[model samples]
Target: MPKILLLFAHPRYEQSRTNHALLRGVGELAEVTFHDLYEAYPEFDIDVAYEKKLLLEHDVIVWHHPFYWYSCPPLLKQWIDVVLEFNWAYGPKGNALADKTCLQVITTGGGSEVYCSAGRNNYSINTFLRPFEQTARLCGMRYLPPYAVTGTHKLTDEELRQHADEYHRILISLRENASVADLKDCEFQDDIPPQLTIS
Candidate 1:
């Protein structure tokens, strides 16, 4: 059985319409543990030991957040700094996350077409996500294809609901008892359509 630990970070979740709906819709599942970093560490003081424990328990680790400055929210960077420690998360004596999987679930205010060389953002979403992929690689973790939901600001109600449902399905596919072929099929490489996790 695989345990999924979802690390959710949104500084102003209240002011958000799209991300809020996405998170809420997916929060109802059985084994999906959503850890709200902002709510958990309002003071910015993260308990590293406890967090490593969570990582140790879960088979897959998900960093869920909005695209803040083409990267993650500050709290997530802080979490990575504190939780993924040397001699614990990497380097000699570190094997905590060696075989575990790390995946990012992100929602962006920008449109998909705009995140390109000729676009305003001037980079693809996957290009901006290389750091995460490399980070997973450094820790000997399998970085799966990320789940990206774009154009949040313009999402219609039906579009939002559709994406929310897709989000739920993706998470459910990672939960304990989900098959291995399901995991392999997702082969994340950035800016791709949804993966077919099952037959």
Candidate 2:
């Protein structure tokens, strides 16, 4: 099983409903380590060495957060700015992250329909996630298709539970070393791997 490190960030975690539920579904997994950024570094002081140690120890890295202004929360961005050092994470001699896999799990208040070619957002969720993909690439990590939980403002109780279950299923599949090659062509999922059949 690939050790997974989840960098979870939420400025107002107590006020979150969807992201919290999604977190609860995967928090207890065997090889998944959860690092709550906001709770750990309230002052935005990221421990670069410690975070680098975690990255080196884990085979899969997940950035879990609510989509804020089409990007990540402030602390996560700050974490990236500090943790991903020049000669350590990327440079002539930096290759510690080679062959590692990175995935983004994000929640959005807007419905999936709003994030399309002619929609209000005017782009897919993946379009807004290019920065993350490029960051992973620069560090020699494989950027997997993002798992997006959308329409949080209107999710019913059953819908929320369904999404959470899907999140759990995906985590299990990833832990079991399931091949997500089918995920290459897509960039988003209502739950997880929307059209990619993983067993």
Candidate 3:
């Protein structure tokens, strides 16, 4: 079983309906360490050593956040910049994160339809997440297609619960060391078939 380090970041978590529910769903799951970046470093001061240690300790790293301005919140970006150093995360000698897995769990305010070449956003969610994909690539990590919850503004409580249930199942699958090889070619895990049906 892979130990998942779920790093969540949201500036205004209290006001978020979808993200709040998603967080609650996985808060007590075993073998998944839920670390809230904003709650841990409200002042934006990240502990580089500790963060790197965390990276080394976990088999899977999950960056959970709301899609802010088509990307992640500032603190997660800062953590990447500061903790993933040149020689440690991505240099000729850096192999700490090699062979590990990375997953992004994001909530977007816009509907899924709005994030496409023909849509108002003019790009897909994966297109917008290229930087994150490249980061994993550079670190020799297998960047899995993201698990997204779109249309946040329109999702009802039950709809949100359904998505949250799926999120929990994804985490559990990862924890149980499920093979995600077939899912590598996918753009979004949410779009994959045979969706989890929880009553």
Highest lDDT: give the candidate number: 3
What shift in Å separates residue 51 of candidate 3 from its native position after superposition?
Answer: 0.6
> Which digits, one per residue and each the tens of the lDDT, describe model 3 over residues 160-199?
8888777887788788877665334333544323322211
- Per-residue accuracy of model 2 over 1-199 as CA lDDT, tens digit each: 7888999999999999998788885767999999999999999988888999999999888999999999999999999899988888899988989888787999999999999988999988988988998898899887777888898999998888888887777666677777676334333553323333323
> In lDDT terms, how accurate is model 2?
0.84
The clash count of every prediction, one per candidate, is: 1, 0, 0
lDDT of each: 0.80, 0.84, 0.84
Candidate 2 lDDT at 92 equals 96
- Worst lDDT window (10 residues) for model 3? 190-199
Q: Could you report the Cα RMSD, in angstroms, for every candidate shown? A: 3.4, 3.5, 4.6
Q: Which 10-residue window of candidate 1 scores lowest in summed lDDT? A: 190-199
Q: Write the per-residue lDDT of candidate 1 for residues 1-199, one digit (tens) a residue.
A: 5778999999998898888888874566777788999999999999888898888888888999999999999999999888888988889998889888777889999988898999999988888998987887788787777778898889999998887777777778777445435655433435534432322
TM-score of 1: 0.89
Error of model 2, residue 55, in angstroms: 0.8
- Alpha-carbon deviation at 187 in model 3, angstroms: 9.3
